[model samples]
Target: MEKIFYYFLIDVPRAMTIWAVLMVLAAAATVGLIMRPRHSGTGTADLAAEPGGPGPDGATPVGAEPALRAEEQRRRALASRALELHRYAEEVTVAAERSAVTAQRRRDEWLTAQEEAESAWQAYEAADVAARRVAAAAVLPEPRTPRTPAEYADRERYLHRAAMAACTRKELSVLQLSDALAHRNGWDPRRHPVEQEIVLRRTVRDSLFAAHRAATERERAAWRDAEVAAEAARSLREEAFAATAKAEEFRRWLPSSPSAGSTDGTAGGANGRVRPAVRWRAARAG
Candidate 1:
């Protein structure tokens, strides 16, 4: 019985030593495997090459692990949205600046039109004064030389005729004189030059006034467009801020819940990560 006990004790130590050595070898192999470089056909490589799963480049590859892929997708989607909103804000800002410039230009044009209208009115007034003076000069009483000599009477008649004929100058064309004589819409036979001159001056004045009104209307429209563009740019900037804030939430790793049905509505990934199951739009309701 003593020899049997001694043999058992010796065998047990050797078996224990062998088991410990095997455990050490297993641990070393596990560490080596963990530190090894990956290539094709390896599990990690296969996961990276999976089709239709989101890669680090913001593309989804196929056959990727569902939970990890979903986490990546959530992060990428948030980042993409943030970048897109930032770019949109920039574009809107540029548009707002352009609209403001257009409004200023319209305002300048409106002012110029006002000046032109004033000048045109002045020209019309001057023309009207001259035409009235000529008309008045032609309306003198006929000379009475009945008791005078024949030469004196003829001279008096010639003087009256020349006064009436002086209103229409040689510069006036035959067609213009005929139109003035014919008494058209706004013409009068007694005031030939006044008829032609007043019509032309009034037409120019009316045209300038109309142009001023149109310029004013265009200025108002441009201002409205500028205001609208500024409002849009402001709103987009706020949205961009909100989007950036929301994207920042996904920058850190979110721990997964061990519960099968989490009350917080967080979805657990296979690698102890989680994604918010609910939409992140609660802050933008206003």
Candidate 2:
């Protein structure tokens, strides 16, 4: 009985210790697996495992990290391209809108210039006609004769007064009257004032014609500038549209990127700065 008791105490304890040690070893192994560190960049330890041994399928873990890294790099490149194209689209759109606005403003200015030119020509024509009528009266002789240059001044002044009496208050400006009467086309001291008026009529007619020519030239230049500006705006609009489409395509190809066409909250947050679809429509319209 004592031997039996000794066997149970010693032998049983020894057997329990052996089983406990085995269980402890298994638990320690499990803890080590749970606590293993992984690379932060790749979020994996496949490279570390490759040197130690092959996987359960009898293949090294070498193929995992490289393919994953390559895919990751490709996605990064797509993201960069999409961002760049979005900015380019925005720049081109702004330039196109500005050109359009400028073209409109120039067109309005051209119209105003055209109207002013027409009015100036009409006024000039009327002045010329009036001066010519007065000059044709030269067929009649001067009512008075002057013997000296000093005497001609008073006599010419008196004759000019008679001519002024026939015109309305605003028919001729004071400055215009002075310039017209200042020159003599061909006159003896006794020549009629009507003959001297011929020079005035010709001067007025030439001035009017010059103004009309200038106005015509301005209208032509304005039209040319407007055409150039319109063309530039159209070209930029097309470019912006193409860029926007290209960027959208890149975004679609990205695996993790939000959908540019999606109206969902997640997509909206991700695509906040770059609304490629909206811009594409706007550019097309422009």
Candidate 3:
């Protein structure tokens, strides 16, 4: 019983170690097989030499050189086709990126152009207003030939006649428009006849309004011109007064005239005679 127990402890351990070592070896062998290069056949020239193994007449065996060459060519063709596909994919990607960049640039350019256009329009409007103001403020020349009261009366009469002519034309237009509208009920109000008549009436009315507005604008423009002329005349008078004052100041510094006792430049001195004085000339500007 003692010997049997000893064998169970020691021999059982040894047997287990042997089984473990066998399992490890088997695992290593399986891994090597999986990693190894595979082949269709180990050395099977009989299958490659011909479709059917060994001819019926039992001729000598042919080599498998043709089959080997065909397989090598197929592999090279497959590699070339894969490389071409990769190059095509790269080209497509580059084209897409370039298109995206170009579109973004164009969008920015368009936005910039729109901004420039708007700014230019605003500047133009500002310039126009400034020009108008400058024109309104510009000085007017004094009349070379003054107009007589009879000429002024004649001008007023002409303006009155023009106004009367405009009124007459407006009355004629209104009469024509009324006559056209009188036929409005002859056809459906929504139909072309009535609609056309309504459109014509609106057109006549708009024309009359436009004419009235134009006449008002003309009168306003004339009044503005008159105001500008008046302002210019006042400015001219002020400038004349300033010139006269400046001339008087210059006269005080001039040498004494022949009638004066002294020709000297200075004012009265201790000797009771004017000292040498500076002579001034009137400088006219062109």
Error of 3 at 179 (Å): 64
lDDT per residue for candidate 3 within 1-286, as digits (tens), equals: 9999999999999999999999999999999999999776644654445653554455533554466456445444443343344344444444444544554555555555555555544544543454455444334432343466665555444433433443355522444434433433231222222233333334434454454555555555555555555455455445444454455453334333222332222344344423234333332211
Q: Top TM-score: which candidate number?
A: 2
lDDT of 2: 0.63
Clashes of each: 8, 0, 8
Worst ten in a row by lDDT for model 2: 258-267
Tens-digit lDDT string for candidate 2 (1-286): 9999989999998999999999999999999999999667552345346654456566656766576567555555555576667677777878878888988887887888788788878877886787778777766766665578766776577546643542333334455555435634432324544454564455556656776788878988887887888788788878878877876776666566323433322232254432323333323425
Worst 10 residues of 3 by lDDT: 185-194
Instruction: Compare candidates 1 and 2 on TM-score and give the better one.
Output: 2
The models' CA-based lDDT, in order, is: 0.52, 0.63, 0.46
Q: How far is candidate 2 from the true structure (C-alpha RMSD, Å)?
A: 17.6
Error of 3 at 235 (Å): 71
Candidate 1 local distance difference test against the native: 0.52
Clashing residue pairs found in predicted model 3: 264-276, 264-277, 265-275, 265-276, 265-277, 266-275, 266-276, 266-277
What is the per-residue lDDT of model 1 for residues 151-268, given as tens digits with 9 covering 90 to 100?
5545444433433343343223345344444545454333333333445444334444554566556656655665665565566556655654545464334444443434344555
Using lDDT as the measure, name the better of candidate 1 and candidate 2: 2
